[model samples]
Target: MGPRKITAHGDKGAEVQGKIRRLGSWRRAAAMIVAVGTVWAGTVMPASADTDLPEYLTKMRAPEMWKVADGTGITVAVIDSGVKDLPELEGRVLPGVSFMEPPVSRPEEKYPVHDDFEGHGTSMIAAIVGDGSGGGPHGLAPGAKVMPIRTSIGSPMAFGAIGEAGKGVRYAADNGAKIINLSIGGWWSLDRIGPAIEYAQSKGVLVFVGMGNDGSKMSNPIAALPGAFGVGAVDINGEPLESSSNGSATDFAAFGGKVPIRCKKNTAWCMQDGGTSYATSLASASAALVWSAHPDWTANQVARVLLQTAGGPVDGAKRNDWVGYGIARPSKVLIDRQGDPGAPDTDPLASPTPQPSTPSADPAAAVPPQAESTAAESDRSWKWPALGAAVAVILGLGITGILKRRRR
Candidate 1:
C-alpha cells in the first residue's frame, strides 16, 4: 500500500502530515523499539510558515542565550538514517561514517552516508545547529558542528540495526564528539548496546537518548541504560507531551510539541512535528551551549551544572519520572550563571564522592565541601530508586507493537 497522510494541528495554526512506519520486532530477543523516523507528511496550512521561527525558540529565549554562547567548538554526533546538507547547515555538518549495507544493486547516487533517506537525521541536525538562513528552522546552538553518523534502524535489517548503532556510538566517542544523540527507541537487550554507551561515558562524552513516543505504556529501554540521559518531550505550556514516554529513566524534558522540522517530502518548507527525538536534540544542544562556554570543564561538570539549573520538578521533588530534573534550561547557566559546576570528576546524578577519574586542572574546578554533601544527600535520596525501577523494566517487560505518534 502507498503511504497515507497524517494531518495534525497545533496552537500556532501550523499543520503537518507524513507517512508512518510501524515498529517491527527482532525475533532474536523478541525486542522492538519505536523508530523516531516517522514523518507525517501532507499539506501544511500555516499562514506564515515560511517566516515564523519555531515557538520553542522564542520560549527558550534563544537569541539572548546565543549572545552568551552558541556552542562554538562543540561537536554533536547524530546517529540515524544520515544527514543531508541544507543551506541552514552550510559549513557546519561534518563528514561522518555510515553502517548501512552498500546499495550495490541500485545506482550509487541513490545512497550515500549523507543521503538522509528518511529525512530523520537531517531534522535532528537542524534542531541542534541549523543557522536559520532563508527561513529554515534555526537550531538551539547555531555555532555548534554536527557529526553525522548514519545507520539503518527501522528497515528490514532490524536485527543488525542495534549493532550498527553501537558502532556509531563508539565512533562518535572516539572521534572527539562532545555529545552523541540517539533518538531511536525500543526494548532491545542491554548486551547489544550497553558497552558502547558505557564507552561513551568513560570517554567523557554525554549521550542524550530519547524516551520514545510510547507515552505511558513504556519508555525506550535504551534510555534506562546506565550513564545515558533519557529525555522526554514537553509542550509549550511546560506540560509533558502526551506522546512522550516517561518513567524513572526520564532524566530531562524539552520542547518537542509542534517542533519545526525540515519537511521530508520537500526541503523548501518546514513542518511542525513532535516526538522525543527532537526533544533529545534540543537537550543535547543545550549541553553544547554550556560546554562551549566552559570549554575547560569536564563532561561531569557540565552535566552537574545543567542538573542544578534545570527547571526543578514541579512537585518540588529532586527529580521525577515525568520530567526528570525538569525541562532543561541552559539559560539558567548561560544568562544567570546560577548552577554550581561542582567537582570535575563527580557525577551529579551519581554519588557525591569524586569518581575515580582524573580531576580537572583548572583552579576553579574544586567542589565546596557543603555542596558535595548536599548534592550527595539529594541525589542518593531519589536516583537509586529510579535506577532500580528502570533496570526492572529492562528485564521484565516484553512489549511490542506500533509506536504511533500522538496528535493533540
Candidate 2:
C-alpha cells in the first residue's frame, strides 16, 4: 500500500495555517498540523472496498467484541474543526452547533452542519463512529451516533480558542453527549476551560482530550485537567510514538501513528495520518462501546473499567508516562468482563487530598488538582518530515521556519 491523495477545500488552507500558528511554538504547531498529512503514506484504497478494516481494529479484536456491544444508543460528541457530510457518516450525525459564532448557531441554509473546514474533524468523527459504508474505514463504535460541534481554534472569527472549546464542551454535555472527544490540543492552562470540564463531569459526561504531538517540548493543559481522559498515541507494536507527549496527565494510549483515515475533501482513503488527536477519538469510541453496553453505568464507572482493563505494565513501579495505562482494550473490558464498575458517585481519577474550605484569591486557583504520571520525557528525534518549501507557501514560511528550528 502507498500514500493516497487528500484534498482540502481551497479556503481552508489559510485557516489551518493560521490555526497552527496560534497553537504555540511553530515546531509543535507544525507537528499537530502535519500529523494529519501522514495519511498520505498509507495504502490508497477505493471507497467501495468493503472487506477491509483498519489494522488497529483487527489487533484489538473488535469483531469478537462487537457480538456483545456495538455502541448502540451512545452519542459521542466530536468537538473539532467540523465533521464533513460523507457517505460513511450518513444518518449517524445528529444536530450539532458551531460555537465559532456568537451565541452559537446551527449551520446556515447554504452549508451542511458537518461541512468540515479542514479534514481533521471529519477524520476524528469517522474514527469514532463511521459505519464503514462506501468502503470507508469503520469506527470502533459503528452503532454510536456523533454530535458534531464545530469550533475554530485560530480563526479571526473564533472567540478565544480556549473559551470556544469550553463552550463546546458545555454544549455537548448539555445536549446528551455521553462521551466528548476533543482531538485538538494546545499549551493553554486549564483555567479557561476548567469550569466547562467540571460542569461536564458533574453531569456525568465523560470527556477525552488529545495529549498533543509536541514530544516533550510542551504538554497539553487540557490533559492535565481533572476529569479529562488524556490519551496518547502508540504504534502498531504497542510502543508509544516519539511524537506523543508524555506526562502524568496522559491516562491511556491508542493507535494514532501510521493509521488509516477517510480524508476530508478527497474521495480516496488516507493511510498513515495520525497523532494524539486520532488517539483521543479511538479512546472516546472505546468508551462508547462500553457505555452503550451498560447504559446504567455512570461516567466514572465506565472510566474505571477502561483503566482497569488497559494493557501495559503490570508492575506498579514501571514507567508509563508515554503510554499511560497502556493501549485501550475495550474488547477486554467487554468480552472478558474485566474491572469493577465501582460506585457511580466516585471518580476514578479523583485526588485523595482534602480540598480547601475557602476559595483562593486567584481566579485561576479554581482549576482542579491532578496527580502526576511517572512517564519520562521522550528524547527521540521528531519522526515526521517537514513539509517542503513548495508546500511552505501554502502553509506559510514562518510556520516552516519554526518547524525547521525545532528539528535542529
Which candidate has the top score in TM-score?
A: 1
Residue-level lDDT for 134 in candidate 1: 65
Q: What is the TM-score of each candidate against the true structure?
A: 0.75, 0.73
- Residue 137 C-alpha lDDT in model 1: 70
Worst 10 residues of 1 by lDDT: 373-382
Q: Candidate 2: misplaced stretches above 4 Å?
A: 1-44, 102-112, 154-159, 187-190, 262-267, 314-319, 351-408
After superposing candidate 1 on the true structure, give the runs of residues whose Cα lies further than 4 Å from its correct spot.
Answer: 1-32, 45-52, 102-111, 264-270, 352-408
**Global lDDT for candidate 2?**
0.63
lDDT per residue as tens, model 2, 1-408: 222121211232342233334445545443432222123334675655565776778888888878989889999998876777787788888889876553235444233446665566777888887877776668889889999887654243332344567888999989999999987654322354666887798889999888776565244555655467778887766656666775655677788766556553444566654778888999999999999889999998898787766765333322255656556788867887877788888876552211111222322111111332223433222122333212322333332222211000
Candidate maximizing lDDT? 1
lDDT scores in order = 0.65, 0.63
In angstroms, the error of model 1 at 318 is 1.4
Q: If candidate 1 were superposed on the true structure by all CA atoms, what would the RMSD be?
A: 14.1
For 281-322, candidate 1 gives per-residue lDDT tens digits of: 999999999999999999888888777766644434555555
Which pairs clash inside model 2? 3-40, 38-272, 38-273, 39-272, 39-273, 42-271, 248-373, 321-375
